[model samples]
Target: MGRDAPAAPRMAAPAAAHAAPAVGDADRRRARDIHVAIVGGGGTGAAILHDLTQRGLRCTLFERGELTSGTTGRHHGQLHSGARYAVGDTDIARECMEEVTILRRIAAESIEMNYGLFIALDDDDVDYTAAFERACSESGIPNRRLSTTDALRHEPGMNPNARHAVMVPDGTIDAYRLPLQFLATARAGGATIRTFCEVTGIDSSDGRVSGLTVRDYRSGRDERIAADVVINAAGPWAGSVAALAGVGLPITPAPGTMVAVKGRLCNMVVSHLHPPGDGDIIVPQRNLSIVGSTQWKVDDPDAIRTPPDDILRLLDRARELVPAFAGAEFHAAWTAVRPLSGRTDAGGRELSRNFQVIAHASDGAAGLFSVTGGKATVLRAMGEAVADDVCRFTSLAIAGRTADTPLLAHREFFRRQERVHEPV
Candidate 1:
């Protein structure tokens, strides 16, 4: 039931090939082959920078705070195998399934292939198991069912009341480390990663984006950065960024709250076999077993609070899968805003998690684009899709190598430039 674009104020049309933005001598920017300005330094932005830089495109990425300060900083960190959404959304399910293997290959060091267990706690869950399995099979998400006893043996903390269980390829991830890897690789490949930089204004001329005005949060100094193309990968704040160019991005900030508890409640990720619901999934990360998430619509991504009721509900639901969670003791909690691709009055859960890359030329603004929606699991794919738009706009023939190449270690991001690439 997740919504796509065309929800409010009308969505932009798909761009026609060869309609790249117009660049002129008046545009003030660094003298480079082709410069792409990336606004936002989260997973999506970092991925875009990685893809473009690997293809020999120069890129400058700006983040208002630290790299993972936005929605990227706070997440459930589930490396989705696409099993959860297979029953409802085939496309997203397939995307997750395909990306899982790719990420395992490219970012192996940051992903935990610990696998996952879906427990059906009641007779209703048992009856729904067949449908779930069918959907996973149909969506190409490999899975195997397990007996209640066998399942408990694997996860000693699993609820004994569980009637059925299914094993999925789901796992945990280092959300921050993964993106930092992307950013680091991009930097090693000659892209600039700027932290504590806020985009203050987007400058446009004759319906074409010329550049953006950025302010250093530390220095309180403004600088103008021009580029052949400007990318809006601002996540939940994408709409506001587009507004600076007098464009309507049709993005709704859907915020979800996740709570982490002390102690690892299980050895693997856990979830309910039923439809997507609040607090239905449990992910064991390191020494902490994190339970998430409750979705709600919010206007401002920055002005959100984790509701006490949400924390209680999450604890109650998580305990159903693992009784140990009932008294695990609270560790940490936070809210993350998802930049869902459409503006709708629909409930947050009803909105789709699919991503959309919009070319502003279709909306009468050239040289600008925005990418929103999807989760951490599909970040590279999201970047590839958007990088295609950027490439087409720049009239470059470079193909994406993000899927094959391992990133430069995050610690080496600022070291002497080195290219991270794999053989074609």
Candidate 2:
């Protein structure tokens, strides 16, 4: 969708960190007339809340657990430059590059622009270099080819046997803080974020969504909330949410395992130079080096168990790229289920990484929508796309301003004294 969207801004100075702009009295009154409910409290939901509120819309978000308790909190935190998907899907690649530029500007405090390198570990990897670089350039992702010596200079910990390397605009994100910033700003704009509140039923009538039945864990009571529209942003659990509304979503909960080791083995993100696959990415977060992941589809997002063999395969792969990875002390091993876009017979590697906003109007649920797939890097874009669709569905002309609006710091989310998990 980003390929057809308007051109993105060029890289520029980061936006000055600021609180959310105040909403006008008239705008607030108008927004209150049409309340929208969002399911899930992950990054996509957070961004959706922020975007809708910024566009002068009344919004409330529901999360069964603490915010970011799902897939959002468990990611390896690589702020992709689109290079990983460049060779296969240039559109998604360009979209990532666009979001990277925007996030650097609006959410600068939550990012680390340490960059990334794709190193060739074998002759086959070296053979893929020319095509990879060309694809990146064609997709508007900046890249640089480097010899083994040059690559080692950037990452002294890398394997000395690396045949060559390529540099891209990859970076690291504070997986928790980035989404919290969106929530913080959304709160400042009058969004109601309810955590530990589970949506048990979708209230619909005459092929239209009317409201929701929710269980408030904090108060041990069930309550109903009226809404004009409902957006399912439940990530890997989107299918289950859609089933509650008597609709179907083609989401695959593809789980991947990641292993974290003690010490920062590399300052920059490192990956294999070949195609995207299992155990390819090694991201440096704070003082830990994280190597991920192995992909396979599962029916239940909640039932995922990190395989012991995945840890071994990841460390072995990490060692191939960074020789020191083998000796690094093991820290943790976990799995994060990806909300991949489609159902597949094979491992989800064949599924496109791009997200989709599916309006359930055709399924006899006029006011229901589900936003699924996509990576953390394009959360803002995912929000914008869904918000735009919501506006069109409601015949509202409000435009999204999230791309230009700077978010409140993640710390601000906690500084506010107001309670978020009140009864209903």
Candidate 3:
């Protein structure tokens, strides 16, 4: 699991913004030697492709739907400053802090750096405020303590009765566009991207994953792809993907429902200063304020039914954070599945937010690895970690440069060039 993996650089690799390498010109001979197939087209898969291409590796990705169709797109889009996890999971918090800084430097275009505020609704929350600052400081997350007056002045939408609030470096991410920037960079660097492709079968020989049978969901065309490595970056569906290869992964799908209401109630991200709870976060996205979320385990990621009660409850909670939220126009509601590593004995909230990169070689399947869990805030860091494992398996000494790589601008993800998206 996460027990003994090599450490990757905490800083981002330098980005090649103006002069990204031409597509289809990557060393074909080298790519043929270590062909890798990454499944899923979410943030993780896109990041992996970016990492692999940065190392000049030959790789292809298959997404069952359009890119960011899963959790990546449905998320509340908080570009975490690691403040949320400081009290519960310091390691992940620290990673988020570093990755957020790196992302701001490399992919600044995809982030809305509006910052955040941790408000104390009452005296009990006041007590927790000290703990929050302490935890954030311990995790190296920068924050500023604010008096009740300053807090209310900064965000008039906050509860008038609130006691204290702290400022943190939280921001909003363009969930749909950020990942595409990575995929676009990969495409520019000679990687293949296949959308609407679902893995129908995992074909292995000699106790190792050798190929995959993928069906184009949009066209119903079946295609076989041979690969030296297969990475499962399927997020909440990672367990399902692993099962096809006859591997058992203790992965639990945790679905969280978020509701978006019209109007940006606050310019800053507002979160409860207490323990993790449903409807505790209200993030401003574009012109709307999104309240997220309620978490519960699920048997199937695709089958999770959105609970209407959650939406109603969130509105009530949002009213606590912002009085205007009471009459805010309804926007949209959706559920996002989180890939939490299973500890059968623990509840969904009890599991660590830290990600796990599993090597299935011990589980009787070589050349197969599964990456599950973690937040979108650390997608590139997670990608680097996964690439470290891939490097070990392929005996490739490629260092990760994703942190510094300026991906194709988020707006240009779909702007196909002459050589981009060339067949691998």
Candidate 4:
């Protein structure tokens, strides 16, 4: 989360409403006064709102708590180059590469292009490293193999037993800054944002979404906000939002936990280059290191919390990679649920990392859409696809120009940076 603020007054009123004359009208007169209600305020939701507002559509972002008080705020802060997914999910890898390139150029102040190291700590994995390099290269992710001596020279803190290493174009990001940047630009474009507002229900009429019922957690007052379309960008709680609409969505919550060590144990993001498993990546953040994560399916997203055992497991694995990390002081820990879609028949781990944009027509519902199951790195592209779908459904003539537009001014990013930390 960026910084906390005192509560503000609610929006003056729901913007003017536009109704569809018929179900299949070709020139379905667009909602001139388009008020889009987004269900989350994390990176994905914020990006969606920014995309909508950039296209000249009005938006109201509803957050249950502070902005980025979700997965976006708790991530390991690695701005991927898709190298992590290159071996298994090439599609997601390509998308990540494209998005990371775009984000680095547009949100320069929010990102630290520190690059990343994928190391093989044992001789048994050196062959795997060769294959990994080939796969990353073929997937268009820049990957270069490094000799053991050269690798150790760059990362003396790395395991002395490391047999091989590959440098990929990954980087650390200020997860908090990126979403706030998106929210700030969205607000500048006339979008209204409400925090501590929990969406209670979705009001529909004649099989089409009409409005939303929201309750203020602090004030204990409920209000109905009219909208032409409702987008479920609720992160791990996306399924819950769909349930409020009486729609059954199959989103499984996969809980992952991260622990913050008191100091930077490594200057670069370090990965074991193994398949998705327990704490295999260590990311360096400001004044500390974020080591994560353990992935397991969970029944509830909201009930997630870091367990003592999880921290112990992470510390054990972290020490195996960097000996100094064995005694690193613990700062804090956090857990977030990643929305995973698929079934037991097809292992969830084997499920595609690509996002699914499900329009309601297939589910016998209208005016409701869900964008689910994608990593934070590619939120921009996912946002573009979602905004385009919304415009198509509402017949809004506004052009989708978010990809070309920078989300924040350089001056604004630096100004906020000065306020958040002591200047060097």
Question: lDDT (CA) for every model shown?
Answer: 0.81, 0.88, 0.83, 0.77
Against the true structure, candidate 4 reaches a TM-score of 0.87
Residue 200 in model 2: lDDT = 95
Give model 2's clash tally. Answer: 0
73-141 per-residue lDDT for model 1 (tens digits)? 688899998988887787888899888888876677677777899998878888989999999888888
What is the alpha-carbon lDDT for the whole of candidate 3? 0.83
- lDDT (Cα, tens digit) per residue for candidate 2, span 1-424: 1222233232212232233335456554665688899999999999999888777778899999999999999998999999999998877899999999889877888887888999998989989999999999999998999999998899888788999999998999999999998998888667899999999999999999999999988889898999999999999999999999999899899899999999999999999999998899999999999999899888999967799999999999899888899789999999999999988888889889999999999998988999988999999999999999998898776678788877877887888637464332
| RMSD to true structure for each model, in Å | 8.9, 4.2, 5.3, 8.3
Q: Backbone clashes in each candidate structure, one number apiece? A: 4, 0, 7, 0
For residues 223-275, write the lDDT of model 3, one tens digit per residue.
Answer: 88898889999999998899989999889898999999889889889999898
Model 1: CA > 4 A from native: 1-32, 414-424
- Deviation from native of the Cα of residue 310 in model 2, angstroms: 0.8
Question: lDDT ranking from best to worst?
Answer: 2, 3, 1, 4
State TM-scores per candidate.
0.90, 0.93, 0.92, 0.87
Model 4, global lDDT: 0.77
Candidate 2, 146: how far from true, in Å? 0.9
Report clash pairs, candidate 2: none
Q: Whose TM-score is higher: candidate 2's or candidate 4's?
A: 2
Instruction: Output the lDDT of residue 264, model 2.
Output: 94
Top candidate (lDDT): 2
